[model samples]
Target: MASPAPTSAPTTAERIRSACARSGGAMLAVEGLDPTTTPVHHLLDDGSFAITVPCDGSLVATVVSAGNAGVQAVLEMTDYAPLPLREPVRSLVWIQGRLRDVPIGEVPALLDLIASTEPNPALLQVNSGSSQGEGDTRLALMRLEIESVVVADATGAESVALSALLGARPDPFCGMESCWLQHMESAHRDVVDRLAARLPASLRRGRVRPLGLDRYGVQLRVEGADGDHDVRLPFAHPVDDVTGLSQAIRVLMGCPFLNGLRARGA
Candidate 1:
């Protein structure tokens, strides 16, 4: 079979934003420090990231000692497949920036601000403290002034500008993407096989698994003897809601009438 022609796809910035939004937390890698996992983090609108760490943690001390100079850091966010696959990692996003600690006095205001947009119980945990143990697990606020953004996924790795990343919006259906892909993998194997027909013969030889979905299209992961290969099957047009997504998937299955029925379902 011939390879399918490419269609409009999400830009690097859009993908970066979406990945960060969907990723609940990230692995924090700072210069001169061992990598640590962050349980609560949020990407601010201004392209900066707000993260929480224990007030008494080594990371907090390191950033505070740096003072206003700030320290270089990178937050690695991983996007995993919703279903069981040979390669579970779907994508990797690196958010590089300078890390600084928000002042104790200013922490409340920052949490409040973040809560207004992206609310998380962790934010509250930062205030009241978590567990009472030998070590104080109370979290403190820290900010990463984003300098660069890069996303490596089925599509590939590309550097995204801070301005473009700030402007780009995450896919509206990103939150539900995992569930949809899970459904396709579990109950709609036939549809997946049909869609695999669109891939090149070389890719078809491998196990074609549903990898991801977005407003633009669906992605497939081809697991073969050599390694894993990612391919995308673009939708005829972008979809916003479930109805449009249903129509697009049906059309991809070469069923135009199903698209009509999906839209008419009131």
Candidate 2:
């Protein structure tokens, strides 16, 4: 994880970039085009992602007729907490854009860009020559030129400017967020139990789960008679490293083992 922005909510660009880094797939919906789901993808530095579809697919045919085929379609990408919790999806980014067919000459450069960043093993299937590659002719790459984006989560929904998303950086923990969070949920039950004891009495009806952890705070989800309620416990200050993160989490959790009693004012 990285430190929160000094003052304002993270730039719309930051959130969008982080969400894209966290997303593996997105739903592509356009009028007169069947929703397409192909995995050979890339999210360029410019805040656009390319999805390869079969040559005969309606999406490509739509593109053949209209240069701005994507202007009316929606490309929805979502990020979910790597671990199980009362609420699994942490954020969603809905991108609306103009879709375009990758020119033949641009495909090589585009594929190179995608390969360098996305290490999806399935990419091994993209062979340009007819010698040994199968399914090459059936595939065509299309790019979504993002015009607008909407990021929604437990925090709420907000529109992010295309420029901001393209300029922002993803969380440092983006790659390992899932693994660490899953470890916390599975290997740290005692810690969760201790944290649960601190929840407001009214919300202790069912279960308490660690919802998320970021430089700014720790989130908890409590299942109650009515439904689930989420609470964010802000750290005293922003944390930029694992040591700081550990100390902050300990302080927030009241350092149960350090003393017989919870810390004062914790």
Candidate 3:
């Protein structure tokens, strides 16, 4: 697919964390640190995530440099989501904020709180075979207080306010979007072709493929010599339920012409 232009959404952080929760792990960069990118396990809940890092690592060393070896530091978290098209990169989220560690005594309770929402197996490792303070000495639990979140997708890149991103929720079909898009491209090629017809004649000359589907619309990617261009066909109304979502897509199909014409034999 073509490179995404910058676009803003209030729900950007939720989408970012949702991508993180789904893909697992992100590229963590700490300023003036030896290791440019640290691979840490993060559990995102509420508006922040607790990242478990190596206690003796360069990242930890940097965090402690400010005399508060026991506290937090500023860092960056970048999350990437893969798309179906040739280019593959569908979304990119960059979150910059302060990262602080949780006291050893509170690790279990924090992990439990995270488990209540999404169970990340890595959090379990922190709970086993380690004693109070011992776990803290060997590992660092860092929390990121998001100062800003930037989301880049097909629509483009947009800076999202922390309040807006925190208050919003992910699309209802988020978890199923990937599989459903794959199914559409593989088994429902005819539907894709029909939908492509809805695009202006100028756009029909290029190769059209089902790009993605969300609560708001179906995205179609057109492959041209210049590059891939994405066009979104907005739904009549946003749908949180699968049934309503189906009806919306069917409406896009121009029901009376697509479905009815075929059922005329009945």
Candidate 4:
């Protein structure tokens, strides 16, 4: 398979914004609360939704509905706080953060905070604690985790490149299973096939698979064996942009682990 011709490169911000526009809109049928007390409505020119209720103190939860997807952000709107009292509602924060390029390690803490501040006292608890309860919250958390992994993996390629430049190497490990990893692996194979065709006959056996999805696009493992020694190439990316696939491969090949393998064959 010949590699596709290069096209213009879009910034990470542009790609994320495009994805959010495509998948961000959501409509939610909220239950377990008095419709009259905290009526949901859209605010902001961009269609960001919110629901506010009168409460003693500054404790408030803002529900953002975009299409069928929704995320609840909680805030303790008060004076003199270290971090912003505002926290994302369930997975909504996570999804929005990824689209906005928030860091990965910070996601779990945000999810946990939303989980703790639930079933607002002013509002009725509809499906709260039921088997199917916390549906929106749970879904949001999952989405956040997935998106976080994908974005982190995509953008972390630079770290891997830097490590290669600094003489870092990969230790052997088996692959983990997850939806994001699976998507990345598929993309890796596609890129590998295209690159293999362009390679000189001697390097034809190069293979690619995902090692993990971190705060980059995906960390990949590329392997080849020249009759004797085994060679492994490690790399990362922020997304599966085919036009940049060749550049990505070149970055991976620079890693010391892969460099060692290539030297073995040489």
Candidate 5:
């Protein structure tokens, strides 16, 4: 037998695209305090990325990139506060970079350095022998819920749409299991409403039974002559929220393995 042709290694972009496809859709759970906010969840598609502390009165930076040879990211300083736009006296050359890596404890010095750069006028004045540290520390806390879906088309135009729908990289910490369930309930309600809107006359004529919620999630059973189809919708936010749920419904409706139930009939 002849030797097989060598396989080419996937390019970074190809790897990213494949990861995005595998992700299908995902929700993020984010949390942090003042200046810098760390996205707790690691996105499957991209290596570790983080959101920098707000500067120039903004809460976030537009562009974020992974750290060099590490599971961390550096905030592109220029995006949030450009040098030309800086107010000379107030801006002390704001060159301190923001970086975060997984197993976060590894960079204690870096963390402290970044934390020091936070807008702490009280601390600055106290060190300068001008004021005490009694002034309020302006800390902003928020929980952001993000859902991402990949839309690849032949024309490559869908990438733009997908990016638009997904928006900027979300804080991963936002998609905690508890938060995920909450979002899932919201999604379930939305889906059920859509299905109800397209209810078939025949089914509407039949008895409508309400199924109660359970530990796993909610279930709604509908009886029909062909057979009873139990429509069980899992309320756990899928890896990728929208695409995962959409694919699940499509599978349930299309598969002969599953009871042929038209969740939304034509």
Candidate 6:
């Protein structure tokens, strides 16, 4: 078999963590409130999440009025394909938790902590606004105390325990996956063609595109005449860095030349 079934891949907990780390799109639906779409969210090291909302938003008002009790909420984080596809959503992580407003004085410290990992510009914006000399900050920071987690993908959906999720780390390549796959699609058509050759003949009947990348392997989307099918080509072994990733990809594409270079550490 050209594209042999992977002996192992990232576990559900790891995948969920990776999805949470790299995904920028999220929708928060609090009990008794409409779903709110926000891009300013971060998964904290402690398995909790922090988000910034408009200071005047209803969510902020609701949390404040509720006080220490907090509001029940479910956050849906979506991981979209780097490239355009018939089905763009690659995976989704549902984080169920209690939503509480973070005190203004503590917002800066939390933002600093989240920035160390993600460093999203929005965090900086919130941080600066909160520390301003005399004014109401436009951004209000809130924390989600995670109670449960569930992740869904092409494979299926699975519930992850809080402890398991906290122990797992995001894939090493997740942050770079979007750009790497985009580069692969534009500058490395020949490599993709070679990879397509490994697909089953039936899947080759339609368009093939690079769907996703991770430490474990590459996932290809085959847009068949009837529908779309996702296929995973696992690496011979899980990779931890770029060098290992390069060697794994070469082996998958059957590029003997590159394999030789990898073997020689060139």
Among the numbered candidates, top lDDT falls to 6
**Residue-by-residue lDDT tens digits, candidate 4, 1-266:** 99764333333333332222222233322234332222211121222323323331121122322323433322111111111212212112112211111123644454334335332321232122244444232122212112121122222421112122123211111112244345544555564454334445555654534443322233334445532111223234333443344345555444344323555656
Residue-by-residue lDDT tens digits, candidate 1, 60-108? 8899999999999998999778879887987898888999988889888
Q: What lDDT would candidate 4 get against the real structure?
A: 0.30
**Model 1 CA deviation exceeding 4 Å by range:** 1-7, 130-136, 154-156, 259-266
For model 6, residues 1-266, the per-residue Cα lDDT tens digits are: 58876555788888887787787768889877778866578777676788877665688889999888999999998988999899999888898999898987887788778778777766655635546556544667788999989988887888999888878888889899999999999999988888889999999988999998888889899998899998888888888899999988988998777634544655
Model 1 residue 206 CA deviation in Å: 1.7
How far off is model 4, as Cα RMSD?
18.2
lDDT of 4 at 222: 41
Q: How do the residues 37-99 of candidate 5 rate in per-residue lDDT, one tens digit apiece? A: 321212222222222222222332222223332222222111111111111111110111224
Candidate 2 lDDT by residue in tens digits, 1-266: 99665531345566667667777766778886678765565668776777766565677778867775444668777778676666688787788888887777887787777878776644544433454355544467788887878988876899977777667677655676677767878998887776777777887777877776666667678877687788767777767788877877787777755424655776
Query: Model 3 clash pairs?
Result: 5-156, 5-157, 6-156, 6-157, 7-156, 7-157
Candidate 3 residue runs with Cα over 4 Å from true position: 1-21, 34-46, 54-56, 64-84, 127-140, 257-266
| Global lDDT of model 6 | 0.83
Please identify model 6 stretches exceeding 4 Å from their true place.
1-7, 127-137, 258-266
Best by TM-score: 6
lDDT of each: 0.83, 0.71, 0.66, 0.30, 0.30, 0.83
lDDT of 1 at 131: 57
Q: How many backbone clashes does candidate 3 have?
A: 6
Q: Rank the candidates by lDDT, best first.
A: 6, 1, 2, 3, 5, 4
Clashing pairs in 2: 13-164, 13-165, 55-138, 70-99, 71-98
Model 5, residue 122: displacement in angstroms? 27
Weakest 10 consecutive residues, lDDT, candidate 2?
123-132
Worst 10 residues of 3 by lDDT: 73-82
